[model samples]
Target: MDNMDFSSFLNFNTVTVAIAVILLILLVSRSLQRPANVPPGPTGYPYVGCIHLLRNRNILEVFRELRGKYGEVFGLKIGPNFTVVINGVEALKEAFVKHADDFSDRPGGFLAEVVFKNKGIGFSSGENWKQNRTFSLSTLRSFGFGRRSLESRIQEEITAYLDVIEKQNGKPYNMKDMTVMAVSNVICSITFGSRFDYNDVKFKQLTSLFAENFRLSSVAGAAQAFPVVRHLPGDLFSVKRLVQNFEDIKEFINEQVIEHRNTLDKDNQRDFIDVFLLQQTKNGEENPVFDDLNLTTTVMNLFVAGTDTTATMIRWAILYIVHYKSVQDKLRQEILKVVGTSRLPSLADKPDMPYYGAFITEVFRMGNIVPLAVPHGAKKDIHFRGMVIPKGSFIIPNLDSVMTDPEVFENPDEFHPERFLGENGQLNGKEKIVMPFSLGRRACLGESLARMELYLFLTSLLQRFEFLPESPDKLPSFDATLGLARASKDYSCRIVKL
Candidate 1:
């Protein structure tokens, strides 16, 4: 009986081992396999794909190295998702502009499911995106989005910004908090029809939430790529916190929406919120797309999108000026030459300030704030430049590649504002190629407002103060803390009133 049992056990063990070997082989083969004619890329481990590649590395640097090895268009299997990184100006323009429809969808995964839930302008796709975008652009334009009329509102925030900075009294101070406040208020004036005081506790909390989510969202890329990561026992990638932040932001927006609805005067529209409420009332029951949820999400998208990014860019601009005193001197000189010290700089002055324009362009390039603009998805199976991009694959536009391309800008690494100028010291048309707002249908919706803010704020600050380092010997590190936006490491500068 014992001999029989031993033989049976050995047979059972052999069967188990055979099954395990077969499964391993199948997994390995499946992981190694690639869709036919897809762009060449690194084949990562089974199931996980190239997730480990991004574990400790900078994503932009990783893409740059991959571009070197795999050419402009490269692929990576990020978990179960197939991602294609598009590099260079020609390829980006071709994919985004030439074939805009085919490459305009936002990938549906963790971000879409949890954070955005297929709502809002930033992440929604198809008819929903079309309707919202069309209405948004039209409405924003009506309210002076890219027009000269909006300059006065932007100037209001700048005055508030300057007053707060003046309180610092030339002692070394980090401009981040005040900058965020001022920039956010610009969005507030347009969206909520009111701007908050710098010390408003609720407003401060709201902005803090936006800033935190920006950093957390960037860190949650792994969760975004791999939905399974979000299911882990603990909030390993801060996914829970991110979702909570969204909920908090949504609640705050909902309150504003409720208030707007109560006070909404359909005959006399005041702000974006008032217009949206009127539209909702007009299309009640017939148009489900213009519901409360969409209103809340759209407002959230505009508020968050309009605030953090512009603030970060302004902060980067300040850091660059502080680091390069020569650039600062030149910028101030140009501002003085054009706008003069009598009043804050205006959009009308923009044409005459070529050096200032070049300086801003250089900041956009060197800052590379939104390094990889929000990931776009393949609307369908796309065939471009002789390679197939499978449907639903993540399309990453490496804006860093285009901005830093040596072919386009000589000494791209060096922060030389003069590269944007012609022999006559006027902005050469090269500034046209500097696409910090990105390109095509899915480009930043707030580009005009952002440009207006950057120009006015930077010029005003330079017009009034000299941004000197706390210590001449120890300039703030040009190194950036990478997030959804590239932000300069926090540094205080001595702001001397000129």
Candidate 2:
């Protein structure tokens, strides 16, 4: 061989050996880096961790596949973040309930730093979170959050939405915006003491921003997992868009807060905003938790969370009923038998409608919205189930795993309401098995309100209208476009008055 050719071959071989040596060193170092009791997981690449595996994969599907290989508790390194996913009911309860404080803090990363900023009750942590959560829950409860007193306001929106549907004249129409408006109005009433028209310019702008935010926030999850990429230009990913969305939402909320401040009455509190204003005034300069920033973020939290989630579930309910004719007929039959057609359904009627309750339970399970419940943080280092959860490590309680556990629900994949019903056809409190609202200390605060909305809205519609797919043979796809919520694809159904 020529001398130059021989030299090139030698150089190539030398480079190859160098790469191999570096990789080996990296593998060994990563193995050594694991603390004593670290959870088992697939070994990721050097620096980037499992980012390559996660970049384009469906996160829920990835978690499910990982659960099969690593059991209920497994660790994943995406970018710079090391996250431990706790799947199934027992593991979830063990972490979130038994060891609540350790797993209660919100994980800090790009999302927390940028979008959330640890301001509101939803994602804030420590004593600030505790105080805000307690006050907000109490304030909401006083304003008829879980109690029967709040039913009238919800029923008002239900009646308004039903009128809109009835005006559709049984023709095919997309239920997305109108349905969201109906649900959002309840939140508006509670927070701002009023409801916006479905077509209001500002209201539409707000919901539109919220919808975009939901999609972008899901994208932000990647940044949370791998904070290294958070610095990249906004044009490359949704993080930039997510930040803008929050700004817009917060601006709207600030405007509302200013309005409430202008008309504050010491002895008279109309709704949540008034109560907050009073609290802020009472605290004056001393209270850090009741200021304008906290108020804006909390209001934003209530709306952004309250609107999309319950509305999406209601939309899913209609889609399920349309896809399964028997379920639709049975749900309608139950509604008729329980509440009758003379007047609107109320919370009082819920106990008598076991099938309805059971159906809602099945919907929560099948909807699998929030497939991975909002990521929690390890408040401190935790030794859980023979694994070490490092302080500040992200904790994901896979509610989907619990809801669909074969032990908890037979044939979990199939959409069967009967699984939630007892042998005697009564709702046997099996709804507890499906936790769409999450659980323990950090569980959703608006859960009671959401539940009441779902029952009243679904029952009201079924009492007056029968929903059917545009084509009897071609039902709307049960498949969801996943994000923070599993929203069904936009589909039009004929809402024939019965």
Candidate 3:
């Protein structure tokens, strides 16, 4: 009887081991499998996915190569997350514009989870995003965004910027700090109802934090992809620093919010904070979208999204203008003819100066600052272009592909502003395809403000100064250092007062 019982126990153990093995096999296979009918590309390893392909390679170059292999719509699984990269103008427009609702959501990752906490317009989605976006847009328009009414405020910052530059006395000086200071101050004026002094310790610290966080975000993207990395011992991916920087920024913004709340006048709204505070009162604290946290996060989004991108574009403009002296000369001639040396270029002059318009278009096209243009997410299971874009996949709009498409821009490789100009020197409609600000519902909230700043600042700068390389033989490198924004390498230029 004892021998019989031992044999029975051994049989039970064997059955249990066999079942465990089968389950293990199934789990591994499940991890390796791709969702049916998703866009086709590399079927990378489980968990890590195609992230290995990006190591030590330019992301743009990698995407271009993948596009060559996988067509316009391709898929990449990055660390358990499925990402779909959309290339070509038609595909992009279809995905972002035609199927706007399906692809209007923002992806959740380290950025949404840690940095933004799904509070702000940039990273948040659903009704919260819609309400905040709608309210912000309406409020911004009322305060002269995308209108000539706000140009005076911008011009005030420009006046201050030019004074700082003039103090340089045409010496070799990197315009990065001053440019960021000027650009950030515009957002400050809109948000805080005032601008900070250039030399103000807090202002400098705040701007530096913005710039540092921008750089760190690119590194922190790893943590975004593989969240496990964020939990590792050291801050290898800069996640800790990024979070700390964000906290510091939030604290600063929160201080402004507190001050605004105390001084807010319901009848006389001074700025964005005042407007938001008044709305908060109307909605009451229980309202999810207009709460204090959302207010701070939204303002943080404005400063972060607004400051770096516009400033980087300005830097790229300066670099390109100096690199292409002929383009610079022509731009100056147009400005001189229309706006003249006596006063800064105005929006009225913008209509008359097609060349200058084309030049800006070319800069937008060539600079491609926000190359990926903030990743979008599939709101639901989307059937796009005969493929299944599974719910929660990261949707990347490759603006670089559209901007640099040979078919769209003839000889897209060359830095020719005339591509945007017709034979009659009018802006050819090709500028419409150059979507540096991206497209559709989740398009940049600060688009109008950015465009206005770019036009005014660049026009005014060219009107006042001739940007020359540090030395005749040492022109700044045109190659951009890839970060959250494609930034121009640090290069000083002699800003000869015109």
Candidate 4:
């Protein structure tokens, strides 16, 4: 009996001790969690961390509201990563400009690692980014980027695009397909040395793939935010679809590369691809950066950046001008006075046309394309305003905050071009008011080309026709299909010749 009692006591004591240890561990973890210096944000569940807010709300709207609730700089635990969002002018300037080197690194997650593999300029970091960016800038410059010489190629494309539109014969049509092709052709010319026919099945497939990637990327928001979730199987976030899209894009680019290789001309380089290939040969074994993979990704970067974003803005431009007839009328009057219908508008005419310039600036502002801008990562722990922004934290410079600041623009909600206009009806020096392309080290590399395209395309179109809604009673919805780029909802319009 004594032995039995002793054994029972020992078993009970063991069980009790184990329970106490587990509880103590849990308590200690809870106490030590997150950091005191981390910016305050909404309460989140373990592991997932504010994913519900991400899925349910418009991310930009959520960030804007959070800025209201938790001050200009706040923290969000997106999955496994702790993210820091900087809103307003002062905070953005500090993070992006002042602490550029510290804030320049791209975040490492499944998106940056598995999908992108740190290959191209947009997402890559450190030496890879430095090499690729320098080469891209110099190579593009050699091809007459940002110069009047490049304008001729764009004008040829413009003429080709205008011919296609003319075939519509004043009838109502959805301009999305043609417009995407037209804008893509400019980059295609520079990269592939030729543009696809409007009805080319392969080209159509490529555009569709690009659009699908954008949708999937936005859908992959949670996975990107919380990279731990990417390891799990099943297409819960459509991650598999996103990967497949990337594969397809690589295949398309590789096919082009193979063709270019077969017809090599080192001395008389045809386009960006030829130049890159020539460099690859010149560098040979010593070059670590200029690989075929880098070539593929850099070209992909150029196409996606040059095509979708610019095309989306042009689409928005058409919608806005149609919605606000007076804006269109004023734009047309300027173009007519500056460059008559007898000849196409030239880049030289830009200096003489300030109202048109203001209109484009307002379009960039009101369009709110690329609202959050590309995500920036902290290379090291950054101390700002009594907060320690942990190393590897995802840095979001809230561009929406800057574009829609109430103090900067009176009545921020209204689409008002006059805000950018001066008393003399010239392009006011309010260039800082809009930032559709983000600022600092990570500003869009294709900015010069995109600007030239927007100017020539907008002026040319307005000079030729009046864009009117298919049904004046019901204008196209201004609401955007929120994704990587904020694209306007599909709508039809009639192009009446001026």
lDDT of each: 0.86, 0.83, 0.88, 0.84
Arrange candidates by lDDT, descending.
3, 1, 4, 2
RMSD values for the candidates in order, in angstroms, are 2.3, 4.7, 2.8, 3.3
The residue ranges of model 2 lying beyond 4 angstroms of the native Cα positions read 1-33, 145-148
Candidate 1, residue 247: CA error in Å? 0.7
Which structure is stronger by lDDT: 1 or 2? Answer: 1
Model 1 stretches astray by more than 4 angstroms: 1-17, 145-149
lDDT of 2 by residue, 65-128 (tens): 9999989999977666677989888888888999886888898777666876787788889887
Collision count of model 4: 0
1-498 per-residue lDDT for model 1 (tens digits): 599999999999999999999999998888778989999999998778898888888878888899999999999898878889999999999999999989888998887767887887888998888888888888887876433246788898899889889889999998887888888888878888878888889998998998888778665687876777788898877889899999999999889888888887766677888887787777783575787777778888887777778998988888888888899988888888877899878898898999988999999999999989989998689998899999989998889998888888888899999988999999989998888888999999989888988898888988999898898887888888787788888889999898
Model 2 lDDT, full chain set: 0.83
For candidate 3, the per-residue lDDT at 72 reads: 99
Give the Cα error of residue 387 in candidate 1, in Å.
1.3
With candidate 3 superimposed using the best TM-score fit, by how many Å does residue 379's alpha carbon deviate from the native? Answer: 3.1
lDDT of 2 at 85: 89
